[model samples]
Target: MTPDLFGRHRAVLPDWLALYYEDPLEITHGEGRHVWDAAGNKYLDFFGGILTTMTAHALPEVAKAVGEQAGRILHSSTLYLNRPMVELAERVACLSGIPDARVFFTTSGTEANDTALLLATAYRRSNTILAMRNSYHGRSFSAVGVTGNRGWSPTSLSPLQTLYVHGGVRTRGPYAHLDDREFTDACVDDLKDLLGHTRAPAALIAEPVQGVGGFTSPPDGLYAAFREVLHERDILWIADEVQTGWGRTGEHFWGWQAHGQNGPPDIVTFAKGIGNGMSVGGVVARAEIMNCLDANSISTFGGTQVTMAAGLANLAYLLEHDLQGNARRVGGLLLERLRAVAARVPHVREVRGRGLMIGVELTRPGSDEAAPEAASAVLEEARAGGLLIGKGGGHDTSALRIAPPMSLTVAEAEEGAAILERALRSV
Candidate 1:
């Protein structure tokens, strides 16, 4: 049965589209943290569909809201009044730190980033963009152009003249040997030198934690230091919070708050988890910049009422239950457990991340060389043990990514960690 489905998929889908596992299972349904494959195998989901299922799978409140909204109205273009869309925008604007903030919704993170690029370029009057090394923003042309990771970026041609900068992944770069303070100082110096060498860029776009780059991050205030340099030159700062937003990191509501010395960013783009599992993405920026586009514009299916309704319900649930606090508490415990598990594993290179967004990088024993084979082995073993996880990294995809739902419980964390420990040991 799996082979027949795989054959059909390969015949219809693009070859570049990738799937997990040696024999991929068709996930039939999910409830809370557990999902059942077509073969009637139940597995605990740790990756949460690339962190898109922020709250949980089949959340009753979100499902009810979506159903109700769909029954009344499916979609209404930007030409008409959309109450749900307006309400969600207002809520997001109030939460966004940007002063005089305005929100624009899109259908996916890629479109949100595309809109951000459009706004930054139009506002600053330059097509040049600054991005970090080993970053993965999206799959769009503009997003790919700015991506410093060669694995995800398939083409060199781009509409924007993107200049890749230093200091996204601190452990693998030239300044990895330095202490945290020295690392930030070196990255700042590099940024200043790069600025001096190039034309004034429209914006510097970056992910707070490079999700696909093994969840790697720099020192907390590194971006704040760079912000000081960018501010002097009137270059905009664009934060791509698709994977790091909505308190996924546990410590802060927004990842940028970790580097809040320079105040809020000029523009912020978000998607993935905002709508729980629904398709909702958007950009929030000061009105002056959001309205900088001279020509009139509208996203045809961007803020359809159904998706907005789902988003509103999901956001309300997250806030009312204080899921951010839950994430901090549970994710803290989970990180400690994973760190303990990593210590006994010979190939585990590093265990890092905040809150629920954790990463365990696998490398050759006693060396920094990435061990992609070990990662693949662990992934397959975890599945055999009834636990589902994710794999990603710029260094040959050797990191095990474990970003479960924000509402994960302590018991679930322990259960998942036990399974992961066995998987690690087996490899």
Candidate 2:
């Protein structure tokens, strides 16, 4: 008999790790945008494993690449020549839009952002970082220090001083009622005012779309405006594209592309989806900035051959299939469907997002107060309805996150939307 240690694994797992649902799911396998639990219950996976499965689950191209590479070699350290890593790096550097770009690989988004912080601080010679309010970067010390959300931030202990800035969330804060142009101006004015009092800082890092912040984002061109201000002051701009990169947003190949008036950011960090669920995270920057450190550095497992092969294949599939276009069409339909449902549901705050990345904010029926309980109920309800979704918010967990695989079809979107409608209304 098989040694089924699943129960023991759960019991002994770290207390810090939060499992979803009252009865946690055990995903045996997946295909396309659907998965099956240990009990063989099928679920239309709207979250796509937190958007890591960018193209599809069990993608044949990626699987073949991984298998072929693993059979040849698995763990060649970054110290050696890795062809797949180099190939993937070339593609990312070209796509990043940063002139004279250099690429560095890491195993996770936390490590990628940590590396970017190191590059910015070292190159600019300042330990200070500017992050948007209600934004989340990662869980590392440097990453968490710059995170402006209270719920996701676990500790205040940080080596660098992080100044919280505005203009990340469009539908919240004092400027929520303002129009797009007015809101942009207010946030810019506030940013200028903040800069006047503080000492010189290294960079202003932001996610064009705040993933864990409930899929929130400022109006278009806000970051370009911010970049203009930062440029004059010689402050670097880092776009944390961990969740928003690789055409997930539909209208743009990169989220920062939507704010291209001032051109690309000084640096860009990417992860989650490029590998189609493989652990692949990296930073792209101007060669000068990336090469600023005099001492030598290399990641032990950052660009392992196997992961790079998977990423190369997955990225190829995404580009070849024009899945970005699919995301645009399917996601627009899904968004419209959800919005129609939200219009009828009293507690539904807003259905917002572009492409496959969408968020439905839940609130109390009669009040502006965050209704996390409602969101949780909706999540459980969706699961029971044979759909899997996720949740986050500027407020403690009041937004439902919907990010199906990029390959989600029109029929699947309709099916998932119908299930979600019932879940939201019932909850």
Most TM-score-accurate candidate? 1
> What are the runs in model 1 whose C-alpha is more than 4 Å off?
none
CA lDDT of every candidate: 0.93, 0.93
TM-score for each prediction?
0.99, 0.98
Candidate RMSDs in order: 0.8, 1.7
List the candidate 2 regions with Cα displacement exceeding 4 Å: 1-7
How well is each residue in 5-109 modelled by candidate 2, as lDDT tens digits? 456766788877887886677888999999998888899999988989999999999999999999999987988999999999999999899999999999999
Task: Give the range of the ten consecutive residues with the poorest summed lDDT in model 2.
Answer: 1-10
In order of listing, the candidates' clash counts read 0, 0
RMSD of 2: 1.7
Question: Residue 142 of model 1: what lDDT?
Answer: 87
Error of 2 at 356 (Å): 0.6
List, residue by residue over 192-300, the lDDT tens digit for candidate 1: 9999999999999999999999899999999999999999999999999999999999998888889889899999999999998889999999999998889989878
